[model samples]
Target: MEEKVGQLAQIAGVPYESEQSEITGPVAEMGIPRKLLPIAGSVLGVSGAETVKRIQDNYLKENRLGIPLIFMVDVIHGFKTIFPIPLAIGASWDTDLAEESARIAAKEAAVSGVHVTFSPMVDLVRDPRWGRVMETTGEDKYLNERFAESFVRGYQNNNDYSDPYAIAACVKHFAGYGAPEGGRDYNTVDMSERQLREHYLSGYKAGIDEGAELVMTSFNTVDGIPATANKWLLDDVLRKEWGFDGVIITDWASLGETIPHGVAANEKEAAQKGIDATVDMEMMTFTYSNHLEELVEEGSVDEEQVDQAVLRILKLKNKLGLFENPYRTASVSDEGSIVFSEENRQKALEVAENSMVLLKNEQNTLPLVPNEEKIALIGPFGTDENLLGAWSWRGEPNTASQVLESMRKVVNEDNLLYSKGSNIEEITTEQLEEAVQTAEKADTIVLALGEHWEMSGEAASRTNIKLPDAQLQLIKRLSELKKPIVTVLFNGRPLDLNGIEEYSDAILEAWFPGTEGGEAVTNILFGKANPSGKLPMSFPENVGQVPIYYNRFNTGRPYESAPNDKYVSKYLDSSNYPKYDFGYGLSYSDFELSPVQLSKNEMTPGDEITASVTVTNKGERAGKEVVQLYIRDLVGEVVRPLKELKGFKKIHLEAGESEEVTFTVTEDMLRYYHPDQTFRSDAGEFEVFINNSSHTSHTETIVLTNK
Candidate 1:
């Protein structure tokens, strides 16, 4: 029983030479004895085939049962060949691209001896101040659900983990971690059970439905109960209700955090609560290892529970084929060949290209003529390598191409000029002067601007999401030149562009484009690749308008923008609408959507209705467009969102081409969690909208009758 208990606890990496390294801080801090190392179920933050093999070889010598250690890492977006951040992937609205990125990530990480990846963080985020928003798919439940399934499929490869390139998919931050109050990370999440089931739980359910092998509990509390110890959430809702038989793991040091949350008195109590909650694994914490056995002996916890947890661990190892071959996919030779291969780099480039959102293109200032215009590339990020964003575990920033390098390929050497206009957060007179001189000599200005790479990710929340004062000042100076200014923003989350919008002729939200970020931006600038990405999360005009989204519920007195009306729900000084709505993006080619057409006006149980629209390319070039389908429950037992994204299709067409897009709405698509906690669809009037973006007004109404 003691050995089995040890298998439920995971530890951080211990160095090859313990006396020469401080890598054992987690071990010593947690008071974990050296003897427990062999029985520990897994290790965190350890990678590379040779290093993993050596650690496993040494642990086997002290093994009582000879169970090999499973290695896990935060391979969120990519392991070696980096791709765009998850928010950017959501903007692409391309499930196939999302899945392909995950497949390439799994392939690269598997050769380096990684068994599981803590990725596809399907948290539906609305607040841009939360730095971890970069890790989420965005505010829409339906879009998050689609990307969730795509990521799981990409990582697991249809549940066939026996293949050398496959790795276990761990969907993370389960149950309302994205809705922290005041947009702070690890803060309290206070919401009704109805809101929880209606919005937050959709993505996790989608990933589980797609066969993700593991679920990681969030750090925040849900409905006043800490998630790691919330039996109602982990067991009743996730395991029993959802029929998820896979293993449940706590976030880093989350098991021990139960005491800080005031739920448990000590480590023993925390361990008992976690086990009772059906958490099969404790990560980076010794609470389970130190107290599980004592809890079992004192009748605080069942011995069978310990056995059950260990059995799940062993079964996972068996499913991963780790028992038969400890070094299942670890090959030092294959690691060099597979990690960042040419083909994989190409995939990264494609994703980066498609993930860029063209926010504004005034007077068609882009697709610059190569020899006719002298280009001035200015800003701190012009040559910076922090384009990989956050959680790129194995990605090397220096290997990525720079914007200057890519631009030099298409533009004449004599026609291109460059200068560092300002640092990410600070500006100097001398730097501004040099940038102004460069812009004055050029016919067009390509201003690269954004937050530093460290500004977003875990533990990196911000109070004001806007262009840094220094960068905005530099933009003001460059705008004085009266030249065509095309701003390429390399940011993690949506920023307030209210100040910079007026000065720039074009704006491109190039998110921290991964390894090929430079090439991708250049491709869009030179018309090699058209930008089709949309805003997954809305861009507020100001930070005060955060938590802003297009699908918000209608109020008793919704804002009508009536002249001299102050009683409505709106800000005194600002409009309620966002600067840019969700699903809003522009391509080089124009797209027009005809009014929606419905096959039938009424639907019954098990009946399906088809909503069709004709999309036409109304410009002089070939491009891709994302046709979004949204639904609104006009009348329901409970208040519902004004519009919920239900379906979308990315289609390509040449100039003067048109295509008809049809979406089938079934009874399942209308189902929602009722106020009484039952999942069912109510018979009522529903409105369907077919539009190029969320702000479109084209709609058709349909009725549902109970039969």
Candidate 2:
């Protein structure tokens, strides 16, 4: 029983020594006995088939029950052949692409001896100031929910545990981690229960419903209770309400963080609170290993509680077939061929091409003709290899293609020019002069700019979310040349483009597109691939509009944009609208959405109303369009959002071709969490809008009457 309890706690990865060293040194540092090292359930941040096999072989010799250690890693984007980050995938608005990316990541990680991946971070994010927004699917609840299900399915592969390519998926930062105060990471998150249920909890629930094997507690406090020990969230909602029986794990060292959160006095009390909340595992924390047994002995926590947690861990291990083969899918033979395979590289390329958002293309500045016009590629990122964003631990930057190398394939050597205008943060007068000299010889300029890859991940928050001043200065100098300029961005978050936007004729938001990033960008620039991705999150005109999103509630006195209007919810210096609204994207081909048509005016219980629209390609080039559907409740017990995305479809069309897109609106779609906390739909008037983006003005209304 003591061994079982010990298995519920995990320790940091032990150093790999050619000659086996005594475990006492490492184990003692974690405040645990040397004997518990073998019984400890799992290890984090360790990979490689040969090393994993050696560690398991040595641990089994000392383990009394021969239970194997589970190897876990943060394979967030990919293992070796990196793909676009989660936020980029969300911009694609293609659930199939999101799922396929996860499948490829799982296959690569499994071959490298990873048993579990802490990924598919389904936190609903609206604030771009949070550095970790780059890790989420973005602001809308419905969109986040759909991507959540796709990611879970991709990692698990229909829950076939014995498949060598499959790895256990752990959905993370459970419950309101994305709504931290002041857009800071690990900050307190306080909101009404109604607000939490309505906006933030849908994505987590979608992942859980799609059969994710584990749930990770968030770092921030939900209400007054830290998520690591919040009983109402973990026990009442996750376990009892959602009927989730999967293992619950804490984020790295989150269990011990209860002390800093002022919830527990010491490690013993933290472990007790964590177990009482039904958390199955503590990652990289001494709370459980140092005090769980003592708590059980003193009857401060029930013995049965420890037993249940242990059983869940055992079940997960057994499900992975670890008992029969501790090194279940680890293979030195497969590692060479599977990790960063050519097939995987091609998949990464396809996703990167689709994930880029075309924010602007004035005067048809893109789709540049090859060899006809002299092209100058200017910036630090022009030949840089740091395209893979943060959280790519195993991804090799050397494998990524540089922009100059990729453009060389399509353009003649004599016609294509290049220059490193400046570093990502600093610019020299000499460097600016050299860049202008290069631009003077070229007919057009491709100015690559954005935040460094490290500027927007965990602990990488910035108060000012804009391009470096140096980059903007370079843009201003090049704009003075009176030559066509197209800006390609390499950022992780939505950047404020107040100054840069006016100078560039066209702008492409190519978020840290991974591995084959350069090749993907080249395809779009040369007209081989059309840009189709939309903004998953809003782009604020300025940093002051930090938490701006499309689904916000209308103020009592809404700003009417009239000359005489005053004293409303309007900023003195800026407008409430975003610089570029969510779901806004441009392609080579223009698309027009017809007025939304409804099957009927009224709906009843168990009856569905079909909302249909026709999308026509109005341009000469073939392209794709994302038809979006939004709903608004005229009246409710609690105020509702002005507009909420309910459904969307991405369709490809030939030039001048038209297609009909339909969405079935059922009673379940209209339901909301009432004041009494029950999920139900109220009898009221509803408004529906079918358009290309969230800022569309066309709409139709419907009514829902009592059965």
Candidate 3:
């Protein structure tokens, strides 16, 4: 591939000695309009297949060194299969489900000619405020490793590109981009080498360990340098330390963002710095065509670098076998056939069924009887087809049924009474009166309201994380109706829901369930499928706890005893406890967890310990429970999280069912990032909890022999 790229470079007649810095502008126009901006050939956005096909036909084919365009998109969660966002999937702790979801996504994405996915974003995010946190698995190296392996397995199936679905996975944000200062998006990240090793970079290593094909650098600068141009991060750490051999893509238009970072004098300089850092792919960003060849001729970018970049790309193309099927999935008919087949919609249903986290149910208010009655479904979002959250590109809003409409599909549509309840953005007196009247005439009210899709992605980050006023007030008003109400929430992050938790009979957290979210919600409501989704981020009571997450080091001055403490990280207005904990979820069926028991409590370095526990379905209905395994590092040189997720298994059982889940604990699963910049676990007493959920982690302590 390198030889091929080299031959192509020679054919282009690019000067071997011209410095990239000396190059000033784009090649003399071939009478093409300078104002016609490029349609993104990479990364998922609104750009359609025809747009990419045009790029392949017009620009790429006529290149001096012809290379076909590789279509890429963000397959962050589940692509078309649309699993819960990475955080929600993380709570499932089901690797098989995670990998299978990715595999389905990869297959569907490939059928559309998308050759690569800027996904399996393995950044270790601890701060909930980072808008992009929804895209990554929760913070913990072991958990991240498990999910990363599943993702790589799903995306890369180790199969040739000719196989129906064979897109390479690109692990993203090369370094500690998740630990931005003040939990602000795109904020500068500064951490000691040891801290970086301990918390953030573990996931990157996990991706590398899984043989990921490509890596995308983060937008934020690590230390002081932008990730796309940081040699220490890209070359010294990623290439030298971990031996990553994949092409590096800049996040969005980060090469140009370097100008904002004040590192580059102009767009050309930023392009040179990024290419000089060996960045091969620029996502949605211009300036590559404007300066790359000129810089190569000026000697700033060596032919070795261009060859290096092209070699990596060609390897991927060859891996995908695009050399033969250049128009893979680009046919107009193929696009028309597989875009949203019934089979795919069923897959979406299965995912939505599994992704719902039953947050709180006071008296099994769920599994609502499929009886014919006057149920007043009152809420601003109840009947909304605005169900499609952010980044939902292809689905037509009217194509799928809304929440109330889906409910009508199962039960008697005539018996189900509906009302607008209130508008999601703002509540008016007329709307309120109509909503209250509807609730007054029903057996129950199903209110659906939450942030719009724009409330949480990119620059849409918010300081206020709660139900929009129109919906909250509507819920309060419906509470006054004295009807049995089930609040179905549609949000991207864990929100403050204490306001209505007491008023509502039940609360269901269904965060942005893709296009078919409404159907999934109704399926669970009508008892067609049980709810098993769980909270992946801590739900702070107020926006004041911006960086809230479940696992964190216990401070020296820990708040103790009283709820209304004056000092020690306590908010004067509210309690420190989050409204919900990480891995927190509820189910119609109840599950009881037994104390964790180790096969051999004490073990030598080479010996393995099997920690096993029993789980019984204490509730009457048959359902699945995610049995969690967590560990606490005792007596460490540096403070460690109160508890870190080590392993989890999702088990299903009938009523009165009991199963023993065994976790094999070896040296690999036991190690943590030490203050010395190496990963190792000091011998001492360890607390192992086999939790029913993240909130209710039941425990047992064991002492090591060497200690």
Q: Which ten residues in a row have the lowest lDDT in candidate 2?
A: 15-24
TM-score of each: 0.98, 0.98, 0.90
Give the count of colliding residue pairs in each prediction.
0, 0, 12
Model 2, global lDDT: 0.90
Residue 117, model 2: lDDT of 89
lDDT of 2 by residue, 468-534 (tens): 9999999999999999999999998998998789998899999999999999999999899999999
The global C-alpha lDDT for each of the candidates, from Candidate 1 onward, is 0.90, 0.90, 0.71
Of the two candidates 2 and 3, the one with more favorable TM-score, higher being better, is: 2
Off by over 4 Å in 3: 1-55, 59-61, 78-84, 284-300, 561-569, 705-707
Model 3 clashes, total count = 12
TM-score of 2: 0.98
- Give the per-residue lDDT of model 3 (tens digit) for 1-707: 22232212110101101231232234222211132122222323422456556555564443444555566677676554455567667666677877877877777677666777777888887666666666777766667878888888888885445566767888888878777876678889988878777768878778778888888888888779888889888888888778887878777767778988999988689778877787877654555655666777788777777777777777876676666656565555665666566776777667767878887787677878765567777776777766555655454556655788787877786568788877778889998899888777778777787777677655555556777777778888778767788888877666767566777888887777766788888988878888877666677777777677677767766775444556675677776677787777888778887878888777666777888898899888899888888887677767877888887888898988999999877755567767666777677777787786656447776655543
